[model samples]
Target: MPAQIYALDISGRRTRPADPLSGHRQESWRVNLLNNNDVLLTQLVGVVGGEFTFNVNAAIRGSGSIEYSGTPLDWNQHRVQPIYRTEAGGAAVEWPLGVFLVATPSSEYKDGDRTVSLEMYDKTKILEDDLIPASYQVAKGSNVITAVRAVLALSGQTRTAFEESTQTLATAMVWPAGTSRLRIINDLLESVNYFSIWVDGDGVFRTSPYLSPADRGMSWEFEDNEKSIYSPEFTHDFDTFDVPNRVIVTGQSDGDTAAPVAVAEDNGTGPFSIATRGRVISRYEEGQEASSQATLQAIAERLLQTGQQVGSTFSIQHAPIPIDLNSVVAFRRGVEAIDVATTLQTISYSMDTGALCSTTLREFIQ
Candidate 1:
C-alpha cells in the first residue's frame, strides 16, 4: 500500500496544497462514519457524521499538553476538515471525510516522543447544542421539503445546500406550539415512506429516500471458507415487546369530528400460538387533509408487512467506496446462489492498513 495523503483544514476551508498532509509530519487517522440508524446515548443519531481520531508528532508543534501547559493548537474552531487520498498507478484519488467540530485533543509521552490525539465530530453536533426558535413554525399544507427547509433555516442552514429527495409529505406536518428541530425532522421522516436525513462530507444536509432503493447498482459477494477475506456478522430474532399486530388510523379534520377511521390486523403468525400473544395497536392521527378509508388501510397494511420482515443486518469489511444509505446492493454467499438485494445501512471506515470500509445493511423487500 502506497502512502495515503491527508490534510487538516480549519473552519471547513478546502486546502489544496502542492504537498498534502501525508507528506507532512503526521502518523495516521481513523474515521468512523455514522448515520441515522446508528445509536448514540441510547438514541437514534442522524444526518450522517463521524468521529475522527488522528495522531500527530509533537515535533510539529512542540511537545506540550494543553490540559497541563500552553499549546500552539487552537481548540476552539468552527470545523476541522480532514481530506485523504491514495496514489494508485501514479494517479491519486481523494476522499474528503466531512468537516468536523474538534471535541477533544489529548497529548501523551510514548518512548522518546510526544504524540497528540485529536477527536472531532461532524457539524450535526450543532443541532444537539442549538435549539429551534420557539416562534418557528411550518404552515399548513406545506410539503416535506418546505417544512425541512424551514427547520434548517432556523440555524442559518438552507435545504438547497444539501442533497435531498424530491419526495413530499403525504400530509402537512403539525408543529403545534413549540417543538425542537430534531423532533420536527423525525416527525417528517415518519410521515414519508422511505426517506432519511444525513449530512455528507461536503457539509451538505441530505434528506433522501433510504431502505427503499429504486436502483440496485453494484454488489459485493463473499463465500465461506477460502472465497472471501472475511465473513459478516448476521443475526435475526423476533421479540413481541414492541411488535404490533394491528394498526389503526383515524382521520379527523378541524371542525369535522365525523371523519371515517380504518384498522388493519394480522391473524396469522404461523402456529406459534396467536392466542398467547396480545394484539399491539398503533394509532396515527391525520393532519392537514383527512385521509380516506382506503389510504388509511393501505398505510396500516404497509406497516404490518414491514414489521413482519424486519430482516437481518450484515456487517462486513471491504474495499472503501462512498456508499450512501438506503442505496440498493447485492450480497451473495457462496453455493447458496440466491442473491440478496439489500439496503446499505451504516458505514465504518479504517485506513491503518489500506482503504477499507465496514458497512451494516438491512435487507430490502420487494
Candidate 2:
C-alpha cells in the first residue's frame, strides 16, 4: 500500500495543490477545515513508524482518536489526515483515514533516526473546551436536528453530517451556565434515538442511532480458510455480569410536578429472559428529555432492547481494511457452537506497509 500524510497551517488554512503528483492531493470528499475553508497542506517527508491507527468507541463524547509514530518533521500545526492507495500502483482506490487534532506528541532518538511519536485526538476535544454561556435555552417542540446544528454553530462548527430526526421536544430544554457544549449536545440527541455522535473520516461532525447486533447485518466474515482475508489470530469473551432484563427510565421533574416515569421489562422468552432468570435484573437511568409517558416509555424500551443477548466480544487479527464503526461482523470456527457474531466497537491499525491489524468486536444480542 502506498500512503501519504497531509497537514494544515497552524491556523488551519491552506490550498489544495493543483498537481496530483505534488503529494498534497488525495481522492476524498473536499472538506473545509474548521479554522478556514481551504484544502490540505504539502505532504510530510519521512518514514512513518507504527500503524496509522484510528479509534472509534461506543460513546457519546470523545468517541474518536488516533496515534502513530514517524520520522521528525516540521509539525507545529494542529490538524492532519492520512490517505492510502490500497494497491500501490495497482488501483486508484484510496482511504482517507479521517482528520485529527495534533496537540500532544512525543519524540524518540534512535541510533541514527529521529522518530516522533504522535498521538492526536478527534475534534470532539475542541468542542469540550468551549463552555456554553448563559441564556442558552432551546424552546419546547423544537426538532432535535435543528437544536444539534444550532449548538454546533455556537461552537463555531460549520460542517456537519447528521442522521434524520423529526421528533420534537415535549418541553423546553434548558441548561445552566458553564456546562460543556458537547454535554448539552449529548443530552439533546437522546431526545431522539441517536446516542453516539462523533467526527467521521472527513472531519465532519456526524450522528447515528445505536442498534442491537440483531438489527444490523454482517459487513465482513472471518473463517480459518485459505480463501479468507488471512485472519491469523482469534479470541472470544462473554460478559454477562451487567446484562439487565428490566430498565427503568425517568424524565426530570419541574418545580411543582413529578417526573414522568416508564419501565421496560424483558419480554423475550429466551434463556436470559425474566421468566428463565427467575428474577427481574433491572437497570435504572434518569434525565430523559421528555414530558409524555409514551416518549419516556419509548426511550426506556430502546435502552433495554439493546444488548439483551448477554453482550460478548470476539477479537481477530487480519489485513487492514476500512470498515466503518458500529459495523456487524461474524466469525465461523469449525465447531458449530464456537461460531460467533458481533458488532465492530473498537478498531486500530498501523501505517506500516502490509502490517496486520488487530480489532475487537462486541457481540450483538441475537
Candidate 3:
C-alpha cells in the first residue's frame, strides 16, 4: 500500500480530498491522514512530487509540502460554505495532489577569533601671548611695622617677638628710604615664622617681617629682549673672635655715638642669660655690620621645636646662627678693654617689611 501523507493549505487548515474521477475512489474512502505531528515522516516515503490536501481544525495552521509514494504531494483547504449541492459535499475532505518537491540548502555557519586594536593620541601646550601680571601694589601710607605685626598675628607668632623685630627694623632704616626699605621688606616676608635682618648704617638689625622672595606675591621675569644678570661678588670672611663678657640691651640709643652707653646693666648671670644678652647687644652696633645670624638661628631652633610638636609647619628652615658662648665672651672682653662704644639708633620700618616678619614663627628658643 502507498504510504499516507498530509499537508496544509495557505490558510494552514488540514483537509484530505477524495479522487472523484478515479474508480479506485470508494464511495466512502476512509483514507487515514498522517498524524498532525508525524507528518515529517512523509519525507522517507517514496512520494517525490504531488499535491495533497487535508483539513484540520481552525487551530492548526502552516504552509509546506510533503513527499510520498515517489511523488510530491501538496495539500490545502478552504472554509466550508453553508450552501452545498450535497450534504456529503458539505463534509470537509482532505484531497491529495502530486507536486514538485525541492529541498532548500541550509545556511553555512563559521566561527573563529576576532581581534581589534585601538590607538589614542593627545598633545598639550601653552599658547597665550600675555599672561596675568606678576606685580603687587603696596598700599599708600601703610606702615611696614604695623603690616608686619598684623601678619605675625595671623601666623600665630608671639606678639612680643614680632613687635621687637619690627621695632629693630624700623629703627635701622630711614622710613620710605628709596627702594632699600622695600627690598628689605620683600626679603623678610615668607610667613609669620621667619624674619629678616639687614645691615644698615647701624650694625645688624631686623626688618619688618616680609615674605620671602619665594613667598612674595610678586614674580619677576626678564624683559623679552633683556639678558640675564648675575649677582654681584661677595666676600666670605671666616675670622673667629673670642668674647670674654657680652651684654645685650633692648633700649634705643645712638649706634654711632663716640661712647654709647649700655641700655641695661648685666650682672654676672647664668651662662644662658649672659650669652643671650651679649648676642642681642652685639647685633646692635654702628656701621652696616648688623647680623641677622642670631635671629635666623633663633628662628631655626624655633622651627625645629614647632616641627617636633606638629610637623613641617613652614617651608624654609629658620635662620641658623651658630653661637659659641666662649667665642662671644672673648670677643666681649676685647671690646670692653678697648672701650669700643657703638651707638644704637631707631627708625620706622616699612609696612611691607614688617608684614613679613609678623608671619614667620620662631621655630627654636635659642
Candidate 4:
C-alpha cells in the first residue's frame, strides 16, 4: 500500500531553499490526526469539524523547540493549514481535506524520546464565536436565503464563502440575545425543511433542501459473506419526548381579540395509549402568515404529521465518495430483507489505521 501524505503550512512561519534553518516541513513528518464525537471523519458541509492532534517526535528537532527559536509550529503567532495528498501517476497530487485551526502545543519526555502534540480544529470554529447582539434581526418578507446571508454577514463570514441555496424561505425571523450565529441559522434552516448545511471540499458553506437517497443516485449493497468488506449497525428509536400527537399553532399578534389558534391531532394512536404523547406549540414560524388562520393550520398539520413516525439510523463501512451529509442513499440488506432508502447523516474516515471509511444514515420521516 502507498504511504499517506501529510503536510503543514503555517501562515506566519514561511520556509524557503535559501534559509539554512526554516521550520516548515511539507514532506516527511510524524503526525497523527485524532477524531472525536463532536466531529466525524467525513468532511460534511454544516457539521462541526473534528479535532486533530499532531504528534512530533523530538528526533526531528533541528533548533530545539518553538519556545526558543520560534522556527516551526508557533503556538501563538501562526495559523496552521493541514494539507493532504495522495499518490497518482507516480507523483503526489493535491487532495485537499479542509483547513484546520491549530491550538496550543504541549510536550513530554519519556524513555529518551521527546514528542509534541498540537491540537487543531476544523473550520466549524468560525461559527462558535459569539455575535454582537445588535446585528441579529432580519426584516419581514425577506427571502429565507437572504435571511441566512444577512446572518452570515454579521458573523464575520465573507460573501465568497457562501454557495447558492436551493430552497427559498419567506418568513419574518428574529434573533435572540447572546446567541451564536450557528444556532440561529440552524433553527431557521430546520423550520423550512432546509436541513442540509455544510462546508464543501472547496471550503464553501452551502445550503440546500433535505436530499432523499434518490437524489444522490448511489446505492450500497451489503452481503452476509466472509469476503465482503462491509459491516453494518442499525439503531431504531421511538422517543416520546421528540414526538407530539397534538400541535397547536398560534398566529401573529392581533388587537383585542385572541390570536388565531390552529390545532392538529393524530387519530392513529391506540386507545390505551397516552391521551397526549406530547404537545408542540408553533408561533409565527415556518412562513405562517400572521393574519391567516388557514396558513397557521397548515403549519400545525406538518408538525403533527412529522412527529408520528418510527425513526431509524444505519451505519456502514467503506462508504464511497460523494456519500456525504444529507445525501439520500439506498441500502440493500441481502436477499432476506427488502431494500430501504435513507439519508446520509454522518461520516468518518481513517487512512492511517485500516484505511477505514464509514457512514451513518437515517430514514427521513418528514
Candidate 5:
C-alpha cells in the first residue's frame, strides 16, 4: 500500500493605510499550505493597482495537500480562505509551482485603483529514511556525477568548434572599409558573365573577357592609351611632443665616460612619418585578375615580414604596441587573404576619402 501524506497550510497578512480624517483602516490576509507544525510556506504582501510578478522557482515533495486563502481585516474574522491548492501523489515526488494574485478593493476602501500582489511558494517532500539533518549527501556508489562531467566536456568541444568555424568565415572576407562598395563588387563578381574590366586610379583600363568562337575560348586585353594613378595614402599626426629628460643605457665599459647621456631634442609633430605613413598603392583594369593576384601577393609578402599568420586561416592583426615616453607611434598593418581568380570584380576600401578606397571584395566561384 502507498504511504499517506498530510496537507501543509500557508498564510500571511499586511496592514493597509488608514484614512486621514475617518481613522478607519484594514489589514489584508492571505493563506496557503502549512506543514505538520502549521508553519506557513507562502506569504502575500499588500497589493497595489492589480498587477504583480516575481521571479521564482519551486519544488515540492511527497503526497502532501496544499491550500491558500485571503481575508480583509475591517470585516468579520475568517478562519481560512483558499487562494491556491494542489494535491500530491503517494510516491516521493517534486512539484514546482508559482502563484499570482489580483484583488479589487472593497467599495468602503477609499481612493485607489484595484490592488494586486504576487506570491511564490516552493514545496518539497522529505523522506524519513533519506532525510539528513544540516548536511548535504555525497554520492557513494554511482557513476552519475562522472557521466554528467563527461557530457559537459563533449558539449564544450562542440561549442568551441562552432565558435572557431564562425570566426574563420568572418576573417575570410576582408572589409577594411566601404561596406556598400564591397556589396556592389561582390554582386558583380558573382553575376557578371562577358569580359571583366576595371579602371585603375591612374586611369589604366584592363580586361579579361570570353572571346567569340573565332578567337577561341578566352582572351586578355590591356589598353595603353591612358596612365592609371596609384595614390594610396597613409598619414599619422602626433598630439604631444615633450622630450624625455633621462636616457638609460646598458653595457657601459669600465673605461667609458661616466657623464649622463644628453637628452634628445624633440622634433616638431607633423602629419607624416617614414614609420607611421608608409602605404602601397596598385592599379588594375576592370577585369585584370592577374593584376589583382600580383597586388595581393605583394601585400602578403610585406605583411609576412611583420606579423605571423593567425592559424590555417589568413588573417593578420597587429601585436600590442609598447608605449614610448611622451609620444604615440602608429604602424602600417594589413592582411591579404582572398585570392582573385576571376575577371568580373569590384574593389573596396577602408579609407574615408579619395577615389580608390579600401573595401572587402567578394568573388563568387562556380
Candidate 6:
C-alpha cells in the first residue's frame, strides 16, 4: 500500500479487534475538513484526491483537489488536513500531509450522481488576496519582524512560527497603496536573510534563515538498497545553460539620491564560480524602491544564493515522509557511481488512497 488511506475515529476500534494495524504497512491515510476557525467540520469519506503539489517557485506554493460523490457544501477558505499514521496498531501516531484551504469548489450532476470537487491551496493564498490600503513602510530603524506580523494581521493570519531576526532595517522599505501583502512579506523575509517561507502541516506560516545545503545534514536517506522506499528508476539532470554566477541589484532612489549598487558573485573555485567558468553569467535587477547599500547587499546575496549554477536535479519516489522544501536528505545510487546529497526543490504527491510521492531534488555539490 502506498498512502494506505484511513479515517479518523477518535473512539472505538480503528481496525479489527485482533489486527489493530497491518504488520508490514503500519496504518492508512486520514483526512479532515475544518472551518475557517480550524474547528472540525467533518471527516472526508469516499473522496479521491488529485495530485497535491508544492513547488518553491510558485506564488500559491501548495495546492490540491479532492472529489467526492456528493453535492458540494459551503467550503471557500475552509481548511483540510491530509493525515497518515506513522506506526502500526494502537501505538501508531498521526501526521498531516499539510493544512490547506479550499480555493475553489465545483459541482456537477451526471448519471443520477452528483460529484463535488474542491480545489485547495495553502494559507499563503490569503496574503495574495489582501492588499495594503495606504502607503506602507517599515521605517529605517524599525524591526522588520514586527512589520511582518502587522501585515499578517491584515488577513487575520496570526498563527506564525518565525525566527526572530535581529536585522534592523537600514533603509525604509516602502510600498504604495494596493500592493500585494504576499510581495511585502516576501521582501521583508529577504531583507533579513530568512527566505524559506511556507505554511506548515498545521497551517502556520513558517520562516527560517537561509542556509546552504552543505551546512545541513540530517533526517532521512535514500539508497539503492532494494528494500528502500525509493523506486528503482533514478534520474539525474543538469540545467547548466542558464546557470548564474553573479547577481547585481541596483537601487532605484525613491526621491533624490539613488543607493549604490550591490553585487554577489561566486568567487571560489567551484565549477559555477566566475573564476572557473571564465564567462560571467550575470543576473541583474533594480529594486522597486531605493534602499541603503547594506540592504541592497543583502538582496544581492539572497538572489545569488537562491539561483545557483550547475543545476543538477534528480527525480525520485519515496514513502510519504514529513518533509518539505527545507528538508535536506542524503542519497546514494551506487550503480552509476552516483553518490551525493540532495535538497528537495519540487515535491508532488498523489493524495488518493494508496498513493505515493514524487520529488525533484537539487544535487548538493559542496
Best by TM-score: 6
Task: Please tell me which model should have the higher TM-score, number 1 or number 4.
Answer: 1
Name model 3 segments beyond 4 Å from true: 1-142, 145-182, 186-194, 197-245, 248-269, 272-284, 287-366
lDDT of 5 at 200: 17
**lDDT of all predictions, in order shown?**
0.46, 0.63, 0.24, 0.44, 0.21, 0.71
Of 1 and 6, the candidate ranking higher by TM-score: 6
lDDT of 3 at 315: 19
Using lDDT as the yardstick, the better of models 3 and 4 is 4
Give stretches of model 1 more than 4 Å off: 1-72, 83-92, 109-116, 133-135, 159-179, 192-194, 209-211, 214-247, 250-255, 258-306, 335-338
Candidate 1 residue 70 C-alpha distance from true site, Å? 14
Best by lDDT: 6
Could you tell which candidate, 1 or 2, scores higher by TM-score? Answer: 2
For candidate 3, lDDT tens digit of each residue in 136-245? 23343344555544433332322132333332231233223232322333333422234342211111123334332222221112111222111122112221232213
Q: In candidate 2, what are the lDDT values of residues 264-286, reduced to their tens digit?
A: 88777865578978888888987
lDDT of prediction 5: 0.21
Lowest lDDT 10-residue stretch of candidate 3: 118-127
lDDT of 5 at 315: 15
**Lowest lDDT 10-residue stretch of candidate 2:** 17-26
TM-score per candidate, chains pooled: 0.60, 0.79, 0.17, 0.57, 0.13, 0.84
C-alpha root-mean-square deviation, each candidate: 11.0, 7.4, 46.1, 12.2, 31.5, 4.9
* Per-residue lDDT over 237-336 for candidate 4, one digit per residue giving the tens place of the 0 to 100 score: 4344445556777654535566567877665453212354434323223334432465456557655544443245566665223233445556566644
Return whichever of 4 and 5 wins on lDDT: 4
